[model samples]
Target: MSDIPQERRVVTAIPGPKSQELQQRRVAAVAAGVGSTLPVFTARVDRGIIEDVDGNRLIDFGSGIAVTSVGASAEAVVRRASAQLQDFTHTCFMVTPYEGYVAVAEALAELTPGDHAKKSALFNSGAEAVENAVKIARAYTKRTAVVVFDHGYHGRTNLTMGMTAKNMPYKHGFGPFAPEVYRVPVAYGYRWPTGAENAGPEAAAQAIDTITKQVGAENVAAIVIEPVLGEGGFIEPAKGFLPEIVKFANDNGIVFVADEIQSGFCRTGQWFACEDEGIVPDLITTAKGIAGGLPLAAVTGRAEIMDAAHAGGLGGTYGGNPVACAGALGAIETMKELDLNAKAKEIEATMKARLTAMQEKFAVIGDIRGRGAMIAIELVKDPATKEPHPEAAAALAKACHAEGVLVLTCGTYGNVLRFLPPLVIGQDLLNEGLDVIENAFAAL
Candidate 1:
């Protein structure tokens, strides 16, 4: 790994020469469906900075969408993964079992919520874990229907696409989605029909009623939701909502699956975001930050529920690649040794304070919501109307990029500016990134 400085510098235009060349090549070779966020290619990365091919150093505020909470080049991850590589790359855990895979499963069983006997199955992406969780739920309950909330993003796989709410970019034209998937209202405090205070109880009631009367909860296998809505604008569903849903699931024998892919692994100031609500999900899907930038994911839940699937029912060829497992163990070690959870809480405090102040100054900032390092601000055209201002978000992100700050925009309406700085990010760099964002709003 390159020893990148913890400074932001722009030596050339945002994309520069090499990135422009690569972008041109990517336009031809890469699939049209795959989109690039900034078109500026990264060459090297430090804790909180990404150095582009043009030698421009940019303050990283996205952390590859919360994947590198321990940093892209974290020392333990590099060391452990490299050692595993030298030993043997892959024998396929199915064909030849390995200790690393079992170790990772054990770590997940210990780390995830709930003390009850638990088991875990590993995969290569969040989508795969989610798909497997649904499979386990269906097998366990002998039911087919799977319920998901509005603005909930599970993954891009076929079944996951059916579970996801968004249409355009994700589900558009990819028709003939999987069947027996249902959608319900989320307790989005900002957009609930009633006030924020009523959102929790009301949305839960509406969801429970719909599941009971419309779909018949007995037919439902699982209810999947994000503790903090990720692609849907970082909407932290109103308080009391999750616990209510969990209760309903328990009452009806439906599996409650918390999709904590973006909010888990200490990104949300806790081991998992569900900890905030003190809700224990029957099954939990996790990825992104689990493996220190490695492609790994897992579906962990009650042992009986997880074991419902028949032997050789839930697995893939590269599900628990030895190197990725090593990376996960190291990542877990890094989290405990560094106390990244506390760091996440500290980051949340610093960021909420800064963003809240910005909200006061900027009328366009309609909401500032998120816990820990996974923070975001929603932009609206009018505070009263709350109309999405995607253009403003786009412009603001462009401004930050020009100033050598890497930021990202997301939301159902594309009006949310989310921040997921690495937990190990220096306070100075994070504050500097915030300073750039402040200037961008002023320029906007």
Candidate 2:
């Protein structure tokens, strides 16, 4: 035999033998409401790849839905977390504060955008960060109404659901959402109503005017938006739009909140997407990739604004879990040492080149957009009409999966394909994944 390491496929199908068995067992043992993104059962994972129980290896373009930026099972993250586990687990920061928690908070204060004095509070997920940001905004502005944009997704909690724009999956039947939450149109260039190409500045001004006129800015506490909308389709506000909105918020005394949950931590090539336009939010919420693979989110913002809440109003039992903090500390250090921000730029370059090529070759690709490593391709039935091709997206994902690559689809119409590959993904692996996508599109 050659010296190359053996590549094995013991079972017949993708899930093989053990995964299907586990699925049955899971169905019998757990609530049917619990869900999964893919059918494969994870056995182990490393940088840019996942291994199912049956030993099938797959490239991870989704990056746990943009969570593990350094890649899964990062060496530094695992090391720090393992060491912290040996020391102690949970003391509940509310009960007994720890150094790791403080370290992470200090890091955030220093790292997040803006030169203004700031503070940070940690939570378990992006949703919690969003909810807390709303609370702080309301308290600081002494107002009742919170303004969110169309295609925005905050969280599953009652208040966040009210603030979120999507309805079917997140807000449907979850009724009677919190009060004083209103929605406005996002600066979505892909589906501009007036058929204006690259209408960023005009869109922002129009949106601000309509919102202020309708809601009477005095009643609005905050205007929360994603620097680059994530689940809503990797939508980036057109140039000149973000700066205009920031000015409008400042003028109206509305807290300008950047929901950077999916766009922060160098995912968009900068520390935060807001930095791309030199826009500093009054409050910024981040999560998904902050702690490598661990669950830890944060609300980092202007000191005075963040301090609006009562001293005891802002924490959770596991708000700053020591283990997650340790992982975050490691994640931050790793980003600096490895220069992941620069790496993110490189990743973006590669994706843009390859995806641009794919766009030219495939008529289904209606638009190619995103900043840094967070890229997406919107699919359409016809370039002239710009009608979403949801079936084409589904078929493309299926074909790519069959050919040993994992891709994900997003967008309100379910026609955009997003790429959130780990910043640490090897160039060869990245190219391989793209090749699979190109082939799938060609077949279609």
Candidate 3:
């Protein structure tokens, strides 16, 4: 159905000649801080494949870090965004309001969890959305402290950097981060010390006790977390964990925020991962897959809470650019029409089956977890010890890349091989990608 051919074709090496030249130019032109998972430069992308500069077609497993869940060039997104571009590019929403921006806000309110009266404010990035959510919570609750979980990743901005848990690349030398941001344990089932069954209650108790004793619940403005942890690893919290945390937040009058930047939209076979457990967050920050590869983010919450800020407290020059809003609307349309949520579930079933089969043969696969299209395999040196095998993870990613399949790795220990294929990916292409992964594991 899609224009892009659904196959992996390696005409040249992974980087190839043209991409190598571009990489050299990039080294001189771009900042060293900007990092790329793969060295190949993309020429075009559609549905499940990305054509590299040297004409090699690689299966897209990362989906630009889950930003293109509807595929990079969905017909709806392209048509709406193209029309919006020709009409008007930017008038600045804060200066002169636009229907597209308002429409996106209305859509978010209707789509996010909870049927209560909700309001939304748009931003340009997930970090900006999160920073604003914190501001709104602090203003409404008259408290300064914020509670986040272990291995959680919020963003890279000043305040968000404080909320993020990883250090090396995200927060190594960035010192003096915003104060009053507290950290607690997450219910990571695979690596839970006391085992999976006890992980839920034990971690929830530790977090609650820590909040009450150390931070004092009354002083905390918000308890922000990801229903399924992203960046810090695609680690889904243990069952019963989110509900207990929600109860504590409700009892303490703390704003419970769900950072669904990476796990939101139709990526997890649901509009939002929180829906999986029937947990409704007071404030939800969404980005990434929200705008069909365009930069758009939103903070949706209860009407009273969202309206707490002063009339002029929220807004940015390019916060809700009309083009991005149009893209978001189109993305939502595509999601609904194509039923990408159900597609995500199908992807999960297919990938889980293949990966589980691979696990039986590869003892290095310590854990296979995640939901829907957002899946990952944790690599370890030995199953008995469960020691992280970051090297193996890196090597496997390299192997996949060399063979013309793009994969990405994450986790605090960096031993996670994450898969975020587009929902529109063909089953044959998906199976081919899995075959490449299996061969890589077998070779190891």
Please list all clashing residue pairs in model 3, or write none if there are none: none
Give a tens-digit lDDT track for model 1, residues 291-403.
Answer: 99999999999999999999999899999899999999999999999999999989988988988889999999999999999999999999999999999999999999899
RMSD of 1: 0.8
Candidate RMSDs in order: 0.8, 2.7, 0.9
User: Over the stretch 1-444, how does candidate 3's per-residue lDDT look in tens digits?
Assistant: 237777899999889999999999999999999999998998889899999889999999999999999999998889899999999999998788989999998999999999999999999999999999999999999999999999999999989999999998999898889999999999998889989898999999999999999999999999999999989889999999999999999998999999999999999999999999999999999999998999999999999999999988999998989999999999999999999999999999999999999999999999999999999999999998899999999999999999989999999999999999998899999999999999999988
Model 2 segments more than 4 A misplaced: 1-12, 195-198
Error of 1 at 106 (Å): 0.6
lDDT of 2 by residue, 79-107 (tens): 89999999999999999899998899899
Q: Residue 288 of model 2: what lDDT?
A: 90
Listed in order, each prediction's TM-score against the native is 0.99, 0.96, 0.99
TM-score of 1: 0.99
* Deviation of model 2 at 303, angstroms: 0.8
Worst 10 residues of 3 by lDDT: 1-10
In lDDT terms, how accurate is model 1?
Answer: 0.93
